[model samples]
Target: MHRSRKADAPRADRVGRAGSGALALLAIAATLAGCQRGSSETPTVPTTGPGGCPAVRAAAQAAVAQAERTDTAWDGPTTGPAAVSGRTVVFVAETMTNPGVAGVANGLREAARVVGWDLRVIDGAGSPAGIQAAMSEAVTLRPSGIVIGGFDPGSTAQQVADAAAAGIPLVGWHAVVAPGPSSRPPLFTNVTTRVEDVAGISAQWIIAHSGGRAGVVVFTDASVPFARTKSDLITAKLATCAGVRLLAYENIPIPDASSRTPREIASLLARFPDTWTHSVAINDLYFADAAPAFRAAGRKGTGPPFNIGAGDGDPSAFQRINSGQYQAATVPEPLTQQGWQIVDEFNRAFSHRPASGYVAPTHVSTAANSAGATTWDPPGYREAYRRIWGR
Candidate 1:
């Protein structure tokens, strides 16, 4: 197990896709199973976008409906495996070095114990090769199921097939698409937020805040396919803004993100100067140094060029948002909540029950809510998963 980062201490710890249509509704219906849907009462959503982007405002308003699902309660398979008391569940973490990964593993460890399941977590070191090796080792154990955090589908196709062939149910957290119950994907299911939508949340905010005329400099991490998708969506959404301009769209693969982010921003600052209004990246980790770099370039303007990111919920990110400086909002996934949910997903698949994989309850933390929120876990969520298992 990797050492967990202290949320109150310092910063750093790095760490999605699409397909949310009819299958999405079915998945939501499955998770919310018996809960009643449909309500004309709409919740008031905050708008960080300027007054020009009605579309952005509408997107924010639409998020209110998801809140009705209320992911705090455990709504997984009620009759799963009678008791997963002796089942050895393998949790394949992308890397414990990252806070989000460590936090998720911690949640699963706690949840597994609560559910009386034997959990063996073979964590990675934040690399593609590391994930592949973990998957390879997991296959030999032939555990009841496997939960992959931050998985890349295209790369892990073979490993997933082998696990499925050997009768090991696989569930991914925030790395692949939910291929639906009928699609029969290599992985049984995926529990995640639509990363593209999460990133778009920030874009929507930017366009509104920018008065619908925004120039965005997008720095995409190409190392992960999910990150690529997020950046692609941000670019595409920004294009829809009435007076949008894409100043620059660069692929800063993880290998180069840390080393190149500041320079990339600095270069964009020099070249486009006033053309760029918002800066969106796959995650805030890439901007560990870029925030100061942005300030260093003396972008002392009014409120136009805001910095926003997804894969939100890191301590430093919240701090940046709270500071009301360069950061505007960071869209965060409820990682700890999803941690327990992943185990439940495996349980459902293991028992041959219809596994409607969950989409982690995600929300964007802006300056308005930074005081009330943190980046590690969802607010007001407790470990009540024991109830889901009828304990």
Candidate 2:
């Protein structure tokens, strides 16, 4: 993902971002880049039968709404040696210029300090080559283990194989879902945010908030797994709404998000002319510039489409979520907590322990409940982890 704010800057109602010296090094090279798709065409997923699409869509959307307020159980290691003193661990992130990404890197560093492990991080600059080079450099050190932050597992296959051959346990954080393809070797452990769930949540929000009948434009990006995962899921979810239909899909590349999202959205709206009542974005950043476009496109009287975002809890996103106007709702990922989870997962894997790290708490914030909320990490989470790690 791309980040525009300083990682360490203060938030109006939240803790400052957790970024270390290593994150600063990667910020300069941080311009997100990713694989581009050939086209945006997508056929709606099939949903038919009695009570019809409207009934089904509403039911499904309601389910998501109920789950949004549900709490998830934390299943990661609670009591154990946090780190082996003098051991070295390396984290290679896609980019730290991103506030959430930088926070994750620092979270791992903070946990590493408790257990006394030497931690090193490399920025991949959001490219295959950058990931490979970072992996290579980490491998050269022959560290206790390696962690990949938000890079494709397939792209890092060779490097992963190399690290494994070198007796290093390779773990991933915020990259892939659990039980990843049998075809692709599973990382010793993958610390993840269930993006499918995130997508389902967003889709339902659009469905319920829009009254089960809406025209939506799904914005997807090829640079990150999340964009694809979310786009496909949301598209499928919307398909179940008999009254709802897809207007179009815009696949923006990472480098083009800031410059192209507005133009693409504008063009889509101009062509459709009030057909879309709401829109869905891969993340808040993807829809950051949409309000002006909505106004310029003459989206008055509520017939024009509004937008919703997922992941990366931008302060603005929360504020807008609470406003309930231009920005409807958003799913905020706990970036810092996930980072420390990576270190815990790594520590468990290094000790030849069982799989015990999974970040399982999340929330979707809307205008009604966004007030005074900042992060997804539960209160006393850091204290809980410390006690569990026996630090």
Candidate 3:
């Protein structure tokens, strides 16, 4: 059985946070515009810094080389509780429209079928009130377990507390900052690749692709702590390569990305037309939203401003990469695999076993290696989980 509802209007407070981030970016653009008025020459990217970029670029290339490998054996847990039969679970999603959240939901749905568990999904529609309401309803259902499917558990503290009081085991898919059991929010386990690994490789991709000299813009949703942290790490990593100039840090919220991205892209183009050589965003969807504006600006699909998403490689992102659209590469989470892990974690909780401390290794996908596939579904995980569950 499945149930879902549309979220109401966003909470005023979250909207304000999103707005402040956007306003800061606009102010940055305005200031840059004033500074560049007399200069017709493109700013030169510094190639020879204190140590020069050759060593850094070489190291980055090697790290990227390892991450791009598609043949990695499954490193997740090989032992776990066998399937607990006839259980019921609820998945409270941030929004079905978010590819990462939806992709994980699809995976969980598949895993639940394999495990013979009843499953329900409630869409939070990308708003605080909606997410809170969805969490409240999820707790009210008294399901055997609840999956916090991509929103911060802290935001729904009262409902989370209620579920905890009821002794419902909770699992999370990117619900917290870390990947293992979270004591603070009482999640059995949180499934995700390490954000530092994801962020580092993404910046390294740009460094390797550009041969160490490029001007870059980073896009992030400040409204989500996970996203903001990833983008901040990306910024810090990019700083290591002195040749890579940080042009702008655009803070467009994920929910408002489609409506605001085109306009922001236009502003970025006008502000740093010649120097902006690359982009990295916290999510792949930003590139999807920026495509039209790039087209209008006469930027080629094969771009000087090569784009890479730091996380969540959805079908659309793969299509863009394979077709040489706006995106060049992505550091994608293994969404389906993580979904299967979520079910596995819940099973462990149900069996009174300890949470599996497995974290998926970060991966980077590019046009050269993607081979036209959609999601970054790693091999052996499905078989491994099935083996563990004795299915």
Candidate 4:
């Protein structure tokens, strides 16, 4: 969750694959159970690649289309001269402690290179005032745009509004709390992981593996506003599928899992003790710590109870999934990818061609599918990144 160092930018030789085709399809499918009805004016779809994956191409094209549709904060002098150059786009996060956020930052720097925008990321130290200071500095520096993915977007509306007042488009990702469901300022475009989509996919996976009925153990934080929102969503969606019951849900603030960890996990194991099961953890970080606890207590196997399902595509959880520890987990593409998309969309919006709507891609890695994968960093993105940044 820490800001990436300037020297750590992707190197010219460390290129990763650009699987927008697979990624796009994954994103679309993740976001929609079914495709949206095509408007009479719906644009043509892009052709597929050698993998015979059409969805990825379609998503890439859709991303481009999305870029075309959204408007930017700039109103005067559309193209007489570039609005800004060698400008920086700062990303302010809750705390720079998560690896997934780092991955996103890498992908974003690459994307910024494509659009000719430089990047400067900051950590919010998980505080409202810290985020405000970051935002204040960003405004003073006047970068082309700013990306804020605070732990609780609700806590920083005033600072965000202030950035808006300075004509900086504040781009927010996952877990955005809208000014209201229907109200959003032109200076902002909220982007998130599409929680319902992620939940639905995770649900589908659980239903398939668990035979439509499973007991769940939800690790949540009732005190944290964002976790509460997601915990509620996961709880309600579990009911959508038949036979799935929340056997027990523990809302222990993370790391504090020490006291409640053994007690609650042991309690759930005692109650449902079968290996054919589907459990849900808030994310990989928590899963990394707790999944093993479940396993140590003899909770891994196939039958009435099985391993828990973790979210957020966090890398550590992916490592566990690779080792045949967890059944499956979802990982967002390198945060660099999301950042790149933001830069692209920002430029488009600034140039008066904002995206209509877009979905960032995700990878659902299971033991069988993710084999031979050494790391999450793709192959071609690095080259693209180096080309953009001249690094």
Best by lDDT: 3
**TM-score (C-alpha) between model 1 and the true structure:** 0.76
lDDT of each: 0.60, 0.63, 0.81, 0.50
Per-residue C-alpha lDDT of model 1 across residues 263-291, encoded as one tens digit per residue:
77677777777766777777776656577
Best-to-worst order by lDDT is: 3, 2, 1, 4
Least well predicted 10-residue stretch by lDDT in candidate 1: 1-10
Regions of candidate 1 where Cα sits further than 4 Å from its true position: 1-17, 20-83, 179-185, 299-304, 379-384
RMSD of each: 10.8, 10.2, 7.0, 13.7
**Highest-scoring model, TM-score:** 3
Residue range with the least summed lDDT across 10 consecutive positions in model 2: 9-18
Q: Model 2 over residues 284-334: C-alpha lDDT tens digits?
A: 867666666666766652334767776676666666666554677777777
Model 1, position 367, has a per-residue lDDT of 67
| TM, every model | 0.76, 0.79, 0.88, 0.67
Report the backbone clash tally of model 2.
Answer: 4
Clashing pairs in 1: 49-208, 49-209, 50-208, 50-209, 277-305, 313-375
Candidate 3 lDDT tens digits, 183-228? 7788888888877778889989999999998888888776566675
Off by over 4 Å in 4: 1-84, 175-187, 224-226, 255-263, 298-305, 308-310, 331-334, 361-363, 374-391
Looking at model 4, report the run of 10 residues with the lowest lDDT sum.
38-47
* 196: Cα error in model 3, Å: 0.7
Model 3 worst lDDT run, 10 consecutive residues: 1-10
Candidate 2 is scored at a TM of 0.79
